[model samples]
Target: MKCKILPPKGLYHPVLPYKQLTSDNTHKLLFGLCRTCMNKISFKCKHIDDPTLNKHDKIHEIKRCKECKNIKNEKCIHSDEERVIVGTWSTIEIDKAIEKGYELQKIYELEHFEKTSTDIFKLYVDTFMKYKQEASGCKCDPKYCKNDCKNDKECKTKIQYIIDNTAYDLDIDKVKYNSGLRFIAKICLNNLWGHFGMRDNFTQKNIVLLLEHITKIVFNEKYKDISTMILDENIVLTEYKEKEEYSKPNPSVNVYIALFTTAHARLKLYELLDILQERVLYMDTDSCIYNDDGSEACKK
Candidate 1:
């Protein structure tokens, strides 16, 4: 009788060398084999751990396995894994948070200004807002309005009231103090109107899309889908444009303006500090830690 030859363990059937297949093809083949072995052995191999691969990779692997396994008596591995869930805030809640933040900044500003005996600083802010509202013809209550009134050219005269009353000539300290106060106030006055405008009866689908768009932007991917969704020519974009033309508060424009003002204030503060030769170690929206030597110089 002729001697019978047997294949090695785990290779009873013909197998291709890994180098013969492309990386993707090899991954699919190994993934299918791993799944079959896992089902029979009731465990996974360390080399083909699920956690090591990302969701997309895992999905692709499983999909390939299902397609290939149909041709043979191989078992298909299916995962009941779900995508990550994100929490969202209501527009009302967001508005409340913004208001609370502004109030906190105001309180801090008041305390600091009062400590420095700069009552005129508070008066200047009040006067600026008063003129600003008058110039803009914004009917919103001054207490709640996040709109900056100083952007109006008509508010220049009002600003002159501040300059005239607060001596820039008699004291360089007063000038620097007022400059710092103006920047801090600018930061406090900012609001997220663009995000606010997008607020509708947000369903789960809409939130998911918004989150996806934000992720795309963060990852530096082309986000035209989300952009078009936001500026849909048929409905939202056209309607918003018409409303804006009528001098209505455009949420998009408001958001851009707020951002610009905040940036301008930050740069202006840095410039003022540079002029005073003060080294700012750390800074945030409303406050900063500068060289303590000239700390009292810009108290207001």
Candidate 2:
């Protein structure tokens, strides 16, 4: 069956408010302010003489006093550098820092920072919701549906009909909003990198089985002893096994590469926009807000 390919939809155009011309750099600045606030209110460990322990050696250490055993306690060798500081500063502190040009070394005497972070968070949520609503209104059938229409000829025909009838000239605002929302959602949901990189327990078992079979085939007499030697409870064997496992093809590497390439493409597009003399106010992974001066270059 010959399937007709539909032309891509036009990109979204957003009308940015003149008052709220903040960029992604602004959020980084706010995060820095929060970090400063966090630093001032948080305490440090007094036990600076404690020596750091190796991972295997630390496993053998017995539990001691609260200060010594607690991972939150900075004195504990197991305590991480980032988690050593405890407690958050008030919203008033953040406001004061902003007002004082982010130079506030100490926490503000008042509690102004309370709603500051929440307000920013709410803005993101609201923006995401708006775009989600717009995208949800798409009446056209999707190209593929895994749940009900896997390789169904009728389903494909219906999808093609929708695609043929659907208008490509969507509202610019809706397009921009949906794109931004998708980017934000991806940021939150694309935490699969860790899982992707993790070794499959089943795959590891299979590898061990394969090794056992090979050993038995090669050295029938000393197969058991060789197997014991190969699978010894030591770091050397463990490291070797891990190296062998990782040397095989990984789907996660391809996923990471795809994500990185997408980011690189976006960066290159931003560079092109700079050459075109456009004033970019904000940009996410997929979408960007720039001054639309009705110029041919700007439109392109």
Best by TM-score: 2
All models: lDDT? Answer: 0.35, 0.37
Q: How close is candidate 2 to the true structure, as a TM-score?
A: 0.22
Model 1, CA-based lDDT: 0.35
Give candidates' CA RMSD values in order.
26.7, 21.5
lDDT of 1 at 18: 15
Q: Per-residue lDDT tens digits of candidate 2, residues 166-252?
A: 443333234222345655655543443334445532222222345555554445442222323355432112111233433555555
Model 2 misplaced stretches (Cα beyond 4 Å): 1-135, 139-251, 254-256, 271-276
Worst 10 residues of 1 by lDDT: 102-111
Clashing pairs in 1: none
Q: Per-residue lDDT of 1-300 in model 1, one digit per residue for the tens?
A: 111111122322111111123323432222112222323322222333478889789767765564345434554343312111111222232233333231111111111123423243355556554333333322234442234534545444444455565433222112222334454545443333234334332222232245555454435432122322454433322111122223334234433233334444545454444444435566555566766664545553
**Which candidate's lDDT is highest?**
2
